[model samples]
Target: MAKTKNVRQTALEILDAIEKNQSYSNLLLNNAIEKNQLPSKDIGLLTELIYGTLQRKMTLDFYLKPFVKNSKKTERWVMNLLRLTLYQMVYLDRIPDRAAIHEAVEIAKKQGHKGIAGMVNGVMRSIQREGLPSMDTISDPLDRLSIETSHPIWLVKRWDKQFGFEKTKEMCEQNLIAPMQTARVNLTRISRDECLETLKEEGFEVEKSPVIPEAIRVLKGNIASSRAFKWGMLTIQDESSMLVAYALGVTENEHILDACAAPGGKSTHLAEKMDNTGEVVSLDLHLHKVKLIRDNAQRLGLGNIRAITMDSRTAGERFEKEMFDRILLDAPCSGLGVMRRKPDIKYVKQEKDLTQLSSIQKDLLGTMAPLVKKGGYLVYSTCTVDEVENQNVVESFLAEHPDFEGDSSFKERMPEAVQPLINGFDLQILPQHIGSDGFYIACLRKKV
Candidate 1:
């Protein structure tokens, strides 16, 4: 029997890898793209198909709910096949409906029995005859958001309760569309203007990010595997993330500590902001992560960064108290902020994960507090908007440690538009409010 190969087939394989086993979407997609030697256009389609299906799983299931009952134990392969067809039928304009149905049946026939193929074809034809499921059918706001936006009900309910219904809906809808690939200009290599000129020369269109001076949003196309990116003219980063290193305000010859730094984006940016003249000790808990930081620094030609494998929770014990002039605690959290970029996060992260991560964040913040010298700066940032992991954690930390206070200087450092969000030094950037990723960054100072 001949095997069929197409974007849909590749997407199904990737989904199976993610569901039956534990596989990162990015890594699996990269491997598949490389192994298949797919054309650039097909590679793009494969990414869209895989990500779109995963991103809208709940919604697709909602549409399929009436078609099949007692679905709790349905075979995952059948479910994924139906979802893939529905994804193309609904989202992709280029792929014709009849073609989508035919491809789906072929895939089903290859993987399952004639009965499964019949079921797949029937359901898709029904959808093509009728329109997609209506929002009115689902009365519960959370359930409606879940089905409409293809997110988990628990997440929708949580957001509705925390951020109001309108904002919750907006967040869910925002995650469906692709995120802009933003990058921070490596001033050490080229100025922002110079980087923009270089990118334009390479046939890349870019627009300056409104939030950060050094960040540029890629408006027209992908730059992940481009020659300019390879040459280190820019590093892909969110505008909010680029602010963390800038908020640290590293100066020449100053000692800096990036506790919990991994993959070293912000740490390398800190070194760059310091003009590569200061010492930036970048530490991560895992050895592999340390290597990642080292690789990023090497690629960017950042010599000022020293990547180390260390647990940040005990940074004060290992490093001298008040030794660093500046410290950045890019604490790990639920990663709710970047949901638009990584759709799998909403499904993978649980409520318990946030609770457990908050405790660790508190401990790490406490342990790293003393590492900053008297009057030195400490920046605490997370890629999440949950109050438990954002404001509440910082408030609790300040209550426990009175010697450190929120630095009002952060307000002065932030752009005028962002300063109002600073409730006396704490900043919470909402996902929908800002086009950038939802990030919470607070600048604290140790009393002299």
Candidate 2:
């Protein structure tokens, strides 16, 4: 009979799959953990190993290069084993170096030859004795920041140029930190205070967001597994994202268009803010995603949302021009801002992706712009910090479409703490500032 793989072995396989197939790390890890039926403790270890190793891939490679000569020539599985083992040694202080090495050697023997096992044992010992090479040797500031933070050098350079050295460094460091599990309370069902009291009664350490009233930050416990979440009293979302509904400032019984809406977090939030009385047309490009939006709405018991599988670029063709009272173009972006939750994005996204995504964002904005009725609100948002995709796109749109003007009054609807962050109609929420996903929101109003 084939041997049952241990947690380390399972983690190595998942990492190997991520490297070989370029699969999403979170999805792959969750599927593997469920398939193996790992215990809670082992599950935690597996998660750390996979995410830590992938999050610091470049740094791990840099540290391994001095020890493992011809690393490129080594088998991909062997290299991943080395990377994950080294990650435990350097970052995870709870696991002893000896135990980590032992596990790696055993996993190596089962997966590879005796020679690979011996090499794994030897390299880990060498790393323990010699320690890692100095990062100070990297002369270029951008290159050093990239290695230290395990972000792509090109991305670091781009951020450096845009946000300057200190802010770029802070953003990179923030990305490496694990994101808090924040959820927006289903205000249509329960008030924020009532939800907090219920969560506290259930022994969860929960706190209301200072900025977004409906947002609750789960400080401890498996929030998704709780009765509150199962009953759809809460929807997992970042505080920054929850603010998009507020930016739209919808009224009761108003018509709202959530262009490019999928999985329906913002759409549901819009419906909740409108007291479940408004019509929220949620559109996505794929049928599967439209179903996902519908599922979320059904879970939250939100009847106001209508999920439609249609491309945002072709929104005007299906809907009457200037039909909606409010239009939200939460454009697809490079996803640089949410890297804390999705570290794999740093490796997968390229420099050219920004230009390509910006073009798509602008096209979506233009397509959805006409759908906002006169005296209606239009809000453009992205989960990216890129200037071209956020500010530049809005600026270019304003230049061509003179009918819409920046709406500064949106700030008045937001928390006073966030009011200072708003410059005219645009607000850029950095992850470090709000301890949430980085987001850019721009509010515009159609001329009456």
Candidate 3:
């Protein structure tokens, strides 16, 4: 007899792997989808189970704590299965609670022995009967907010300190919501209007992104399968991400460097902004990722991109000083900003990672500083809202290097909606502001 595949089982496997820090949510999901070749309905259900459980993990844990008979005896898979079931019971209105419980029991029995199955059934039935513990019971304000929003307590404290209570709460709440699908039009290949018409013609439920003129908000349909995407007319990207090339004040025929570029979203945007007239030398550490950049550029029909596999830290050695007209260091980050789209990120990132990543970000910034030509823009960006990785890194660099000053042209450079969010020369875009990913971008100009 052949073994049957189920979304719950696959979800548990991926969730367990995430707990062990094996791979990222997006990467794992894509791989699993391709491997199983499941129907579209099952794919949607699988996606919902994994992301929903991850998004409400802490809250689900709080609900399960009073129900589980023995914590130490429980296997990680059992715990994840329970989380998956409970998440559906609480969050997914379409799924009946009893149906979710019955599925959990079946999955538990198949994955483990009868004892495990009984335990899972007992816990789930009790949850359905007794109702979850009251949020009011968590006396501490921060503790309550953390559980309610399913964020870590330490992170809540840190963000509450950095952004104040109201904003922190809003950001945390936003993290649980599903991110909108948005894509950028490759203006180099086709006008945004033409791309919009093409996407509409392809039956995509889409509209122009209010955030950026070159981007569109996708309401329905897969952009990957659309003819416009295949024809190099569009690329799926976040509205905030679409702003990096603008922050550079990129102009036609200007040479650019995209340090730490992988998958080349911003690198391609830079090239498009330059109308494919000048070189956009993109660098990454891995050969496969360099190929992703090349593939994307090729798909977009952009010929000005030059992708190479090399550690971005070593980029200074490979290029002469003051070589590029502008440089983009979209540095590696804790990825706390994109949590809405990838809930597993909150679980994987630790506070210590911030300090470590900050050091690396500063080093990358320092290394690439000399490569930006006189008066050229050095646009430092990250998909994170943490102060240590954003402001502190840029501020420290500016203090140590007086030859570079914050480029306030970002006032005119960014879309008007984003100008007021600017801080000095940098902007910290909290995810709640525009339903976009939390992002930080700072423009610096090398003093003439």
TM-score of each: 0.95, 0.97, 0.97
Model 3, runs deviating above 4 Å: 1-5
Worst 10 residues of 1 by lDDT: 1-10
Segments in model 1 whose C-alpha atoms lie over 4 Å from true places: 1-4
lDDT of 2 at 141: 86
lDDT of 1 by residue, 396-420 (tens): 9999989999887777777665766
- Judging by lDDT, tell me the better candidate of 1 and 2: 2
Error of 3 at 300 (Å): 0.9
Give all candidates' CA lDDT scores.
Answer: 0.84, 0.90, 0.89
Q: Over the stretch 294-360, how does candidate 2's per-residue lDDT look in tens digits?
A: 9999999999999998888888789999899999989999889998877889999998899999999
Candidate 2 regions off by >4 Å?
1-5
Q: Give the least accurate 10-residue stretch of model 2, judged by summed lDDT.
A: 1-10
Q: Can you write out model 3's per-residue Cα lDDT over 1-448, one digit (the tens) per residue? A: 0122377788889998888775788889989999988778788888888888989999998999999877657888899989998898889899888778877788888889898999998898887789889998989999999999899988999999999999999999999888999999998778888888888998999888887989999998778889998888988899999889889878888889999889999999999888889899999999999999999999998999999999999987899999999999999999999998888788778999999999999999999999999988899999999999999999999999999999876778789888889877999999999899999999999999
Model 1 TM-score (2 dp): 0.95
